[model samples]
Structure formats: C-alpha cells, structure tokens
Target: MGDFLDKRAEHLSTGMKQKTNIARAVVHQPDVVVLDEPTTGLDIMTKQNIIEFIRDLKADNTPVVFSTHHLDEVALLCDSVCLIDRGTSRFCGSIEAFKEVGQSGELNDAFMNIVKQGTMHV
Candidate 1:
C-alpha cells in the first residue's frame, strides 16, 4: 500500500492501480463480489494471477459476478452464463448448454447464433 500510494494517483502504472483497486475490493471478505472486466488491459501474467484469485474466491464459496468480453475467461471461471445484448438477455444457462446452441458446439459460435436470432431461453 505504501509503495503504490500516490498523492496525485498518477504515480502508479495502470496495472499497479488495478491491483490496488482489487486489494481494496477483497479486503473486507464480502460474500458477493461484482467485478467488471477485471482482467481487461492487464498483461497476460497479471491476468492469469487475477484468474487464479477468482478461482480461489470460488473455492471459498464466495459468489463472484464477472462481466467480460473474454469468452475464454468465462470458460475458465464460470459454470453458468447469462448473455445479454442490447439491454436484453439473450441466453441464460450452464456453459454446456450455451455450447449446445451452436452447430460447432463452441461458445463463441453459440453466442453469435444467439445474437443473430435475438432470442432467449430459460
């Protein structure tokens, strides 16, 4: 905290500032956490570290809601997915179910199909 702290909040690099913000979020041990694109703009190593942190949170049975454009991260960390587009939810189900929506059985393809169809399933 001491090394990263800056009076003007500009001394720290983007990654360091992101880490500091993350430390603040977890300091309280809250039951639920909502992280929006936590790995965005981070280096690959830092992104992996954050991903591991998220897995640790899951192991602790803490609920984490992460909104990201990175489908790979979703595959790694999420069991369920709610895909929303244009302020509407297009699909909500397990990751397997999501993959089943496409002929290729790939999450990205399924997502594209859902967007093209503009439909939702419970």
Candidate 2:
C-alpha cells in the first residue's frame, strides 16, 4: 500500500488519479464498488486497461457500479446499464438490449435514440 502510494502519489495524470481511486476503493475488499466517470480523460489503451481491471473484479463477484458519459465504455464494461438524462432514468437494460435500440451498432447512438424519444430532459 505504501509502495503504491510512493510510486503514484506524485505528478499523477487524470487517468492515474482514477486508477489510484479504484485501487483505494478495492484495497479494503468491499462487496460493492461504485465508480463515476472512471474513464474520463484516459487514452484508449488506458481505458482498455481500466475496463479489463473492472471486468476482472466483476468476475471475482465484486459488484461494481460505474457512471460515465461514454456510452461505448458502458457498452463494453457494463452487464446492465441505467441511462440517466437530466436526473431521470431514460433507459435501463442489458447492453445487448440497448444495442437493439439503434441501427448503427454504437451505444452512443442507442443512447441518443432513447434520449430523442422525449423521456429525458436532455
């Protein structure tokens, strides 16, 4: 723990900060983990790493709730997603179900389709 801090505590990038936050959250071995915008400001490779890490955690039966504006990230990392727009739950379902909402095969497109349906304030 101290070694991790010594290595990453100084001059951390946004992605590194997010990773540190995740490490801190999981260090105690909690039953549930909730992350908000976990991949914001990360490069593609870094995002992939974070997604894989979360997947591993889930495989270990750790319940994780991640919030992000990146619908593609949600598609890749979430088993189920609840899309909130203007503080309202506009859509909630499995990623496959959400994908069926759009023809473009993109989660962001599906999300936009649902949002355009007038259920959400945004």
Angstrom error at residue 89, model 2: 0.8
Q: Which stretches of candidate 2 lie over 4 Å from their true place?
A: 1-11, 101-104, 120-122
Per-residue error at 20 for model 1, in Å? 2.4
lDDT of 1 by residue, 3-74 (tens): 655544567778877776788788998889878789877899999999999999999999999899999999
Residue 22 of model 1, lDDT score: 81
Task: Give the least accurate 10-residue stretch of model 1, judged by summed lDDT.
Answer: 1-10
Q: Return the TM-score for each candidate structure.
A: 0.89, 0.78
- Model 2, residue 28: displacement in angstroms? 0.7
29-118 per-residue lDDT for model 2 (tens digits): 888998878888788998888889899988998999988887667766788878787878876777777677543478878778887875
The prediction achieving the highest lDDT against the true structure is 1
Q: After the best TM-score superposition of candidate 1, give how far the Cα of residue 89 lies from its true spot, in angstroms.
A: 0.6
Clashes of 1: 0
